[model samples]
Structure formats: structure tokens, C-alpha cells
Target: MYIVGLSCYFHDASACVIRDGDIIAAAQEERFSRIKHDPKFPEKALTYCLQESKITLKEVDQIVFYDRLDQKRYRILDTYTSFAPLGKTMLWNAIRKWCGPSNPENDLYHSINTLSKKDGKIFYPHEIEFVDHHFSHAASAFFPSPYMESAILTIDGVGEYATTSYGQGKDNHVTLERQINFPNSLGLLYSAFTAYLGFRVNSGEYKVMGLAPYGSPTFQDRITEHIISWNPDGTYRLNSEYFNFFATEQITSSKFHKLFGGPPRKRESKITPKECDIAASIQAVTEEAILRLATYVREATNQKNLCLAGGVALNCVANSKLLRKKTFDHIWVQPAAGDAGGALGAALGFYYHYQKNERKISMNPYDSMKGCALGPSFSNEEIEIFLRKQGYPFERLSDRELFSKVSDLLVHEKVIGWFSGRMEFGPRALGHRSIIADPRSKKMQSLLNLKIKYRESFRPFAPSVLAERAGDYFELRTDSPYMLFVAQVASKHRIPVTEEAQKAQGIDAVKLQRSTIPAVTHVDYSARIQTVHKDTNSRYYHLIKTFEEKTDCAVLINTSFNVRGEPIVCTIQDAYRCFMRTEMDVFVLENYLLRKENQPVLFEDET
Candidate 1:
């Protein structure tokens, strides 16, 4: 039997298809539409899923949507009705978005009719099912994890009535034991601070995480007292008077602005030390809550293993903290822990719970994500065809030759856009679609952010270390295949801070060399790490191995290959366009290489 799982009309809309409980294909719509965080019906993603799987809608046995629209609609209506004219705009917006003509109900049927018309037949009307939002998040984390049973926690902005849920999964079943409802969300609480700090909500939370290490946690007390009141039982309540999200579309209220003693920071404004301290304070408090919640989940479930999902699970700092507590013997997180992974979870949930498929666990390194490389991949022929059509200069070399050449360029400090294999499904680039650089270069962190990424300078880069050698550079032993956990730089490799570096504040500290691999190390000496196994990505492993042979360092900077305000490149065309626009020195699509100097001038020389 075949199952098509989908999540849409939410940020990062996506779709996935599974055959006999194995994922066949999965992709986000924004990658195809070129609209960052596209929240429309995932028709394009669904089309890609069908095409990638070499199947059609008629062949699918079930179409399970990630969330129950009607139940969510009821929650929105109930909340707005309680607030009345105070929530008029929010109410109207929710009504139009969910109850409008292009709503999920209509869109689902329209997709079937439009896409399945060729056969004069379609999937049965009963094939579709809409799951609860939090349930989907829980299922996404627990079902695909390599555990016979585990404690599950899912936290994000409100999902219907639930914002945070704690549960347990054993075999094919997941039981949500407790939940915290809307207007009292940890996700929204953090987002409120995100907006107050001049960053976009949802997308900019990671930016806050990156900035936290730059400042001291001076406002942790004020945030705890005024913004969110903590309960002892792994739950909390938001001070709605200080948060406007319940009645207004805005993330923060006037009270929130006054509490912080300023208006929200404007975008493109220079980030001050105050913003850094605020980021640090909130991160500190948030980590505490996450630890308390994880402890509570473990105590309540009596499970030895734990799984995490939802937007909060994407906070790598909190993840690192939770890992330190050792509340559970093993912890596994859904790499795409946000709404994108919801699509994959919804499908898995339907397969196990609804269809009663046998549960399977692939332990040691865990679960069925296949390193989250479950997206489209083009053959050498397809890549070459695109390159020739675009009139871009290129080279075709053998795998060994390509690795040798790219490794040599890295030794000389050239930023190379490495695009190979299938695109990664999760938010992380892994090694398949990444911008690789020599981690030994102290100046590379600033250069890549300002020149190539065109984003905030405070942001830190992650390291993709050779799996066997990860222990040498980072204080870690387990495989971090997904780049989900932040580990401290191994003490042996850390550089002592200078008096000048210690006195530096704000962005100046970025100039300080914190470790041997300073480009990938944060100010606090932490690195979000991805361990590249030779078993999974041999090509990426070989490239890093070649570089290691040349420089005696196995770690390299591996960041998503895109600029600010852009999704990670999904096609060779997207890769080329990004390469031409950025200050990237080299571009590698599959085994082909293209240098910026030899390419046609994309713009008139400003000099």
C-alpha cells in the first residue's frame, strides 16, 4: 500500500510519499517555488513527490494531511470570540485564510481532479485524513526514531489548542499524556523577543540563538517574572498582557516594548550590546524551561530514551543543554523538527497508527531519514545539460580528481559551493548542498557572512567533521549526523583568550580567535557539529579526508549554500544563480567545477 503525507497552509509547506512504510520522496514547496517559507497548498511539492517516486495520485492508498483544519478552525474561532473586537483583525485573517475558497478542503479535491484527470479515475474519497497538529509533531519525533519506546515532547507556536505536548511512544503507538494550550507557548514567547530584537519571527529565532553567546544573561529574572511564569510540573503560562499575538498579528505588545525599555529594533539597524544581552538572557531562561520539561517528560513516562520535535527542537543550544543533563540514556531529534518534518511525520503516523503497520527500529545511528537526503537528484547528464544551456564555463573531472582539486582550493582559502547528491530535506545543508571552507582560517567566518551569505555577522557557522575524527576537535563521541547539537571545542584545541579579546564587546569579539578552528567555533567555544560518516556520504567524507591529508585538520565549515532571504539551492540553476550573485570563489555542481573569474560578467565592474 502507498501513503502520501502532507503539511501545508503553514510555513515551510511540504509533502512526502511512502511505500510500505519506507519514505520514497519528500520535499518542501519553497525549494521548488523559490519563495522562502511558502505557506500555500503544497501542490508543486506534491507533484515533485509523485514524479520523484514515479507514481501518480491514483496509485496512492492514502493522503494524510498534517493537521486537522476544522479542529484548528474551532480553536481560532473560540479564542477570537472570547476576545471579540479586541481580536477582530486576527479573527478575520484566520477566517479568510482557513475558511476561504482556496482552503485545504477545496485544495485537496482540486489537486486530485487536476492531477489525476488523465486516468479518468482518482484516489477514493476516504483516502484523506487530517491529524491533530501536535500529534503530527509527536509522531514525527517518536515513530521514526530508533527506540522501542521513548518520551516525546513537541513545542511550538500554538497548534489548535495545544502549544506544548508531552507523550510516550512504544512500538507503533504514541500517547500524549499532557499538554499546555494556546496563548501560553514557549515558541511564541521566544518569538516575541525575536521581534522585539528586530528579527523576523519563526525564521529569525536561530539568529537570536547565534547572538546569545556574545552577551551576559542580565535580564533572565525580568523575563521570568514578566513574560512567562513557570510552573513546577514542566509547564508554563505566558503573560498575555505583555504579548499581542493573541489579539494582534504582531509578535509583541506595547507592554512588552515598555518592559524592554524601548521600541522594537528596526530591521537593518546596527545591533547594540543591549540586544545581545537580551538574546543571552532569553536563551538562558529558555534552556532552563527545556531542561525542566525534558525532566518532567522522563519522570512521567519512565522511558529511558527521549525524542524531540516541533520548532523549539530546532534550538541547538537548548538541545545541547538537554543532552548534558543525561535525563535519558539516548536522545533522538527529528532533524527537520519544524513544520516541514510534520509532513514526513503525518505520513509515518498514518502508516503506523491508522494502517497498523509494524514498527521497525534501525538503531546504533538510528532511524529512517537516510541522512535526510530524500529529495530530488540530477544525474551527471542532467547537470551538464543545464550548464551547457546556461553558457556557463565548467570542468568535468573524475571523483578523485574533483576531490583533489576542491581540497587544494580550500587549502588556499577559496569558498567553494559544493552541490552534490540529492538535496537535504531538513533545514540543515549537511554536506550534500553546502558552502565549504577551510575552518583553520580565522577570517573566513567574517568573510563568508559579509561576502557570500550576506547575512548577520553575529551568526556562527557549523562544522562537518569526519566522523572518526570528530572526537579530536569537539567534546563529542556520538554521531551528530544532522547538525542538531552544539558541542564545545575540545579543550586541547582551544586558544586562550587575550586581554584585548576579553575586553572587546558586540561584534568586535568575532575578530577574536577562540580556537584552532576559529571560523567554525563560537565565542563561547561551542560548535554546532555534523559528523560525516563514510558509510553515508563517501564523497563529502573523501573531500574532507583529502583536505585533512593536506592540512592535518579534519573539520571544515559547512553552511547552507544560499544568501540571506533565499532558500537553500535545490537545482543546478539555483546554484549557478547564487554563485553568480555572491562573492563565492568557486562553484561545484556534482563533479563539474566553475570558477567566478572565467564566467561571463554578471554585473558591470564597479571599479
Candidate 2:
């Protein structure tokens, strides 16, 4: 049976298709729309999934939306009514909600109607059902995890009324034991700090995490003492007076600014020591809270494994700490551990909850993500056709020859866009849709970022290493196929550089000649690594192996295939468009290779 899952009307709208218990395709609307964090219904993504799976809407046995709109609306109304004689800000928010195009019921009905129109010849009414938001997140986390039974946790900004949930999952069944309601959320607390620290809330949490390493946690006491109170039971309440999420138009109020001893930092401004300290303090606090929650869940469920999902679960630093704590023998985090993953969760939940199908526990030691290559892919014939039609000169090589050529290019310090197989489902670019270069190239990181990504300089690139050899490079023992963990680089590989080299070298300088593989290593001598296994992603593994044979190094710099503020490429056309827009030296789509010099001048005017 075919199941269609969807999450929309919130940021990172997405779709997923599941057949039996296996995922067929999953994608976020932002990828197709070229909009970062697009919140519209994922019509394009759904269309791609159906086309990729060769199925029509009518052929889908069930349609599941990631969250129940009625439940969410009820919570909103309840929260707003309780604050009656509502201030102007609250009144405006209510008005917008009641009449907004983003209203939950309106969006649901509109999405259904729009899909029906597109599938007019094939669709029938009453085909879609709504799943609870937190349940969807829980299912997404547990169903694909490598455990037969595990305790489940989902935490996000807000899903319907639940911002956080604790549950237990065994095989096909999942049961929720507790949940934290709206207006009192760890996600909001973090997001409030994100806003205060001059980053966009919801989207800027990662920035905060990245900046935390630069500062001391001097403000931790102030945060825990005046801003929020934590309970011994792993539940906490915020001092609402300092927060503006419920009653005010802003995320941070005047009191919050006053308490922080400054106004909100302006975007694009220089990062100060104060900002770093605040980021470090909040990050430390957030990790502590998550650890306490995980401990509580472990004791409550008596489960040896834990499955994590939701936006907060995407905090790789916290996840790394949790793994180190050993609260659970094993921990699995959904790759798309955000709202996008909710689409997949809803589908899995529908399969088990509504259909009552028995689930099979298959861990797939590499990870159940199937490399998360769940988006569209093109055949060599299609790519050649596009190249021919566009009058672009290209070469078609055998698989062995193609790998050899790309490997040689990497050895020469050339940056190549490696577009092969299916696009990834999450924010991460897992080899299939990646920009690759020799990790040993001193100039590669800066070259790729300044000329290609066009983003902040301090951001670091990741290393994709051979799975069997990962332990030799990183301080990690298990397979990190999803690139979710941040571990220290093995000390043996550290590079020694003079203080003058560091001072003269900007964030980009850290990219050049600090180590044997200077491009991918961070200033801290660590790399966020993705281990590639042949069985899980044969093509990517072969490419990396070929590179290793050519250079005697088993690692390469890998970053998402997109520019700043854009979603990762999804379609072959999107990949081509990005390749043409960037300074990448070559584009490898399947067995076809196209050179930048031979292509039309599509990006001549782009900054």
C-alpha cells in the first residue's frame, strides 16, 4: 500500500511517500521553490514524490498530514482567550490568525483542494487524515531508528499545542506518556535567546550553537536565575515577564533587553564577546536541560535505547553531549529532525496507528535513512539530453572512468559539484547532492565559500570519510552516516601552525595548510564528519575510494549544493542551475561530466 505524508503551513513544509514500511521519496518545498524555509503547502514536493514513485493520488492508500489543525487552533484560541483584555499586540495576532491564509484549517482545506485540482482526473474526496504533530515527530524518530524498542522524545518550537513530548515505542506501537504545552517550551527559550543574540529565531539556532564555542559561559547563572527556572523533575517554566512570545509582537521584550544589559544585536554586525558569552551560556543551559530530560525519560521508560526528533534534537552539540553521557546505551536522531521530518513521521504513524500494520525491526546498521537520498535523480540519458539541448560540451564516461576523473580532479584541488542518485531529504547534503574538494587543499575551504557559498566566513565545511576508516580520522567509533555528530579530530592528525599564520589567515585561512588535510579541519582541529559506506551509498563510496587511491587520503570536503540563503538543490535542473551560478569547476551528474568553460555564461552577472 502507498501512504502519502505531508507537513505544511509552518516553516520547512515538506512531503514524504512510503510504500509498505520503506520510504520512497521525501523532500522539502524550499528546495523546489528556491526559498529558504518556505512555509507554503508542499505541492511541488508532493508532485515530485508521486512522479518519482510512479503513483497517482488515487493510488495512494492513505494521506496523512503531519499535525491536527483543529487541535492546534484550539490551543491558540485557549491561549489567547485566557489573556483577555488582550493588548494591541495580542489582539493583532488573534486577528491575523483568524483571517490569515496560514490558518490551519484554511491551509489544510486549500492544500487538499489544490492537490485535488492537480490530480483532478485521479483523486477522490476524504482521502486525507490528520495526525497529531508531536506523534508525527515521535514516529519519525523511532520508526527508522536501529532499535526494536526505545524511549522517544520530540521537542520543537511548537507543534499544535505540544512543544515537547515523551513517549515509548516498541515495534509498530508508540504511546505518549507526557507532554509540555505551549507558552512554556525549551525551544522558545532557546529561540528567545537566538533573537536576543541577533539571529533569526527558528532558523538561527544553529548560528548560536556555532558561536558558542568562542565564548565563556559567564551569563549562565543570570539566565538560570532570572530568566527561567528548572524543576528537579526535568520540567521548567520561563519567567514570562522577560519573554514576548505570547502577549507581545516581538520574541524578546524590553525587560529581556534590560536584563541582558543591551539592545538586540543588529544583523550583519560584528560579533562581540558579549554575544558569544550569551550564546555559550544559553547553549550550556539548553544542553543541561536536554540531559536532565533524557535522564528522566530513561528512568521513566526503563528503555536502553532512545530515539530523538524535533527541532531541538538538531542541536548536534547537545546530541554529542547526550551520547557521551551514556544515559541510553544507544541513541538515534532523525536526520531531518525538524518540521520537515514531521512529514515522514506522520506517514509512519498512519501506517502503524490507522492501518494497525505490524512493524518489522530492521536496523540497517549503516542507518535506516538509506543515505537520505529520497529526492529526484536523473538518468545519464536525461542529463546528456539536457547538456546537448543547452549546447554544453560534456563527456560521458564509464562508471570506473567517471570516478577516476573526479578523483583526479579532487587531487588537483578542484571543486566539483557531485550530483548523483537521489537528492537528500534533510538539511544535510549526504554526498549525493554535495560540493566536493580535496580535504588536503589549503585553499579549498575559502575558495568554495567566498566564490561559491557566499556566506559568513567562520562557518566550517564537513568531511565525508570512508566508513571503515572513520575511527582513524575522528574521535568517533560508531557510524555517523548522517553527519549529525560533532566529535574531536583525532590528535594524531592535528596540524601545527605559527600564531602569525593564524592571525593573518581569516576564518578562510584556517582552511589552508594547517594540517595534512587543512581544508576540512576546523580551528579546533575537529571536523563534522560523514562516514560513507559502500553498501548504503555505493556510488558515493566508490567516488571517495577512488579519491583515496589517488591521494592516499580517505577524506574530502563536502558541503551542501546550494548558495547562501537558498535550500539545497532538489532536481537535476536545480543542480544544473546551482552549478552554473557557482564557481565550481565541473558538474558530475551520474556518469556525465560538464566543464565550467564549456557551459553558457549563466552566472556572469551574479555577485
Candidate 3:
């Protein structure tokens, strides 16, 4: 049976199509639309999945949406109405979103109609079923995970009435034992701090996590005392007194504003020591909460393995702490752990659990995310067609020749936009859609951030190392193919601290060379790692291996293929556009390699 799953009208709207018991294709709308977090109906993503699956909409046997609209409406309306006259604007906005043009149902129907008409075909499924939002997240965690039985945890901003849900999964079935409802969300608490720190709410949480190591957690006591109360069983409650999200649509409360100082930091303003301290405090708090939660799950399930999902699972720093705590014998986090993966989870849940189909364990040790390379891919012919149509100059070479050439460019500290195979479904760019540079270059990180990424200079890049050599460079001993774990650079590669540098504070600490692989190492000598296994992506592995052979360094700086505010490039045109826009030195598309000098000049995007 074929199942089509969708999550839309929220951040990272996405679609996934599964055939029988395997994921055929998946992608997020932001990728195709060139938006950072597209909240549209995901028509383009759905169409792409269907095309990748070689099926039409009519051929899809089951349609499963990621959330129950009615349940969500109930909780949303209830929360807004309780705030009453004070929430007048917020209540009206919520009502308008549900009942007016913002209604997902309307966009979905229109998208389906438009797609069908554009294709000169019309069809509809028998019925569209909506699963609980948190269930979709939980299913995304446990179903494709490399565990027959495990403890499951899902935490996000809000999904209907559930903000955090935890339980256990056994075989093909999973159950939630308990849940912490909205207004008590760990995700929101983090996001509120994110906003207060002058970062975008959902999108800027990672920025907060990244900035934490720069300062001391001095504000931890004040935050814990005034903002939240916590229990040992992974349960947490935001005092609600310090948050006005439900009533004002502004995440922080008046008390929250005063506690953290009068006014929130304005976006794009200078990052202050106070902001860094706040980030550190919240990050420490988050790690404590997740660790407590993980400990609780381990005790409750008595299970050796654990599966984690939801947006909060995106916190690599916290994830690293949890992994180090050894609460479980094994942990498998859904690579696309946020709402994007909910599309895949909803389909998988309906197929194996609801359909009564037999479950099959993956032969691969890491489970069935397919390297998270489940998006659209174009053949060399198509790539050549695009180049030709655009009057672009390119040279085609054999894989061996191209690898050697690109490795040479990387060795010379040239930033290369590497586009190969299928696009990744999640926020990460795993080799297939990555901008790579020599990690050994001391100035490469700053160069790439300013010249190519056009974003914050404080953001550190990740290292894509050969799987066999990962432990040789990073403290991590396990597979982190998804770039989801932040592990310290192995001590052997760390640079000795100087007396002057030892006193370096804030981003100055970031400026110090903490490791031999300076470009990929963070201020604390931590590196978000993606270990490349030959079996999953042989070409990328071979390229890195070739680079290693030449330089005796297995690590290379890997960042997503797009600039600061854009999604990863999904199409050949998208790749070309980004390459032309950035100050990248080279572009690699499959076996073809093209230099920027050889291409036609285009208007540079300095934004």
C-alpha cells in the first residue's frame, strides 16, 4: 500500500510518501520554495515526493495528516479565551487563522485542486485522517529508529494540547505514558529566551545553544527561581506568570522582561555579555531538563535503547550531555526530529501500527533514514540540460578525476559548493548538499562565514570526517552521520592554551585556536560531527578519504549549501543561484566541476 503523509501550516511544512513499509521520498516546502521556514500547504513538496515515488496523487492509498485540527483548535481557543479581554487581539488572530484564509484545510484543498488541474488530472483520496500532533512526533522517533523496543520522548513548542510526551515503544507499537501540556513547554521556554536574546523564536534556539559556551551561567538561579519550577521525573512547568505568549503573542511576560532587564535585545543588534549569560543560563537549564527526562524514561521503561524526536531534540549540546550521561545503552534520534519528520512519522505510524502490517528491522545498523538523503535528485543529463539552458560553462569528468580535483581545491582552502545525489530532508546538509573547505585553515571559518554564508561570525562549522577516523578526531565513538551530536575535538588534536588566550572571554575564546582543526572547532573545542560511512555515501566518503590521503587530515569543514536566511538548495538552479550569489570559489554538481570564473557573471546577492 502507498501512504502519503503531510505536515503543513506550521514551520517546516513537509511531505513524505511511503511504499509498502519503506519511505520512498520526503522533502520540506522550504527547500523548494526558497523560504527559510515555509508555512504553506507543502504542495510543491508533496508534488516532488509523488514524482520521486513515480506515483500520482490518485495512486496514493492512504492520506495521513500530522495533526488533528479540531483538537488543536480546542486547545488554542481554550487558552486564548481564558486570557479573555487581555487576549482580545491574540484570540481574534487565532480565530482568524483557524476559520479564515489562514485555515490549512482551505490551502490543502486548493493545493490539491491546483496540482491536479496543472497536471491535467483530478483525483481525491477516500478520506484524509489526522493523527495527534505529538503522536506523529513520537512515531517519527520510534518507528524508523534502530530499536525494536525503546523509551520514546517527544518535546516541541506545542502540538495540540501536548508540549512534552514520553512513553515506551516495543516492536511495531508505541505508547505515551504521560504528557506535559502547553504553557509548560521546554521548547517554548527555550524559544522565549531565544527571543529575549534577540534571536528569532523557533529558528534562533540553535543560535542560543551556540552562544551558551561563551559566557557563565550566572543567571541560572534567577531564571529557575522566577520563571519555572521543575520535578525530577522530567516534568517541568513554566510559572506562566513570566510568559505572555498565549495572551500577547509575545513570548516573554512583563515579569520576564524585568527579570532579564527592561527590554529584549533587538534583532541584528550587537550580542552583549548579558545576552550570552542569558543564553548560557537557559542552555544549562535545558540540559538539566533533558537529562532528567532521559533518566526518567530509562527508569520507567527499563529499556536499554531510547528514541528521541520533536524540535527540542535538535539541541545537539543537550543531546551530547544526555549521551554522555549514559542513561540508555543506545540512543537513536530522528535526523529530521522536528515537524518536517512528522510527515514521515505520520505515514509510518499509519502503515505499521494502524494497518497491521508486519514490521521489518533495517539491515543497516543505523536504521532506515536512508542517510536522510530522501529528497529530489537529478541525473547528469538533467544537470547538463540546466547548464546548457542557462548558457553556463562546465566540465564533466570521471568520479575519480572529480574527487581528486575537488580534494585538491579543498586542500588549497577553496570553498566548494558540493551538490550530489538526493537532497537531504532535514535542516542539515550531509555531504550531498554542502559547502566544504579545508578544516586545517585557521582563517577558513571566518572567510566562509563572511564571504559565503553572510551570517554571524560566531557560528562554528561542523566537520565531515570519515566514519573510521571520527574517533581519532572527535571524542565521540559512535556514528553521528546525521550531524546531530556535538562532541569535543579529541584532546590529541587540541592546541595548547597560551597564558593570554586562557583569559580570553566571550567570542574572543571562539577566536582562539582550540584545535588543530581550527575552522571546525567551537570555542569549547566541541565539533558537531557527521561521520561519513562508505556504504551510505561512497562518493563523499571516497572524496574525504582522498583528501585525507593527501593532507593526513580526515576532517573537512561542512556547512549547508545556502546562506544565512535561506534553505538548502534543492534544485540544480538553486545550486547555481547560490554559487553565483556567494563568494564561493568552485561548484561541484555530480561528476561535473565548474569554476566561478568560467561561469557567466550574475548580480551578486549581498543580502
lDDT of 3 by residue, 306-423 (tens): 8999999999889888999898888889999999999999999998878878788888788888999999988999988878877788999999899899989998889999999999
Q: Against the true structure, what is every candidate's RMSD?
A: 2.2, 2.7, 1.9
Clashes of each: 0, 1, 0
lDDT of 3 at 471: 89
lDDT of model number 3? 0.88
**How well does each candidate superpose onto the true structure, as a TM-score?**
0.97, 0.94, 0.97
Encode model 1's per-residue lDDT on 356-379: one tens digit a residue.
889877643557888888888889
lDDT by residue (tens digit), candidate 2, 312-391: 99888888889988998888999999999999999988898668888876656645677788988888888887778777
- How much is the lDDT of residue 547 in candidate 2? 87
Worst 10 residues of 3 by lDDT: 118-127
User: Which scores higher on TM-score, 1 or 2?
Assistant: 1
**lDDT order of candidates, top first:** 3, 1, 2
Off by over 4 Å in 1: 98-100, 123-125, 603-607
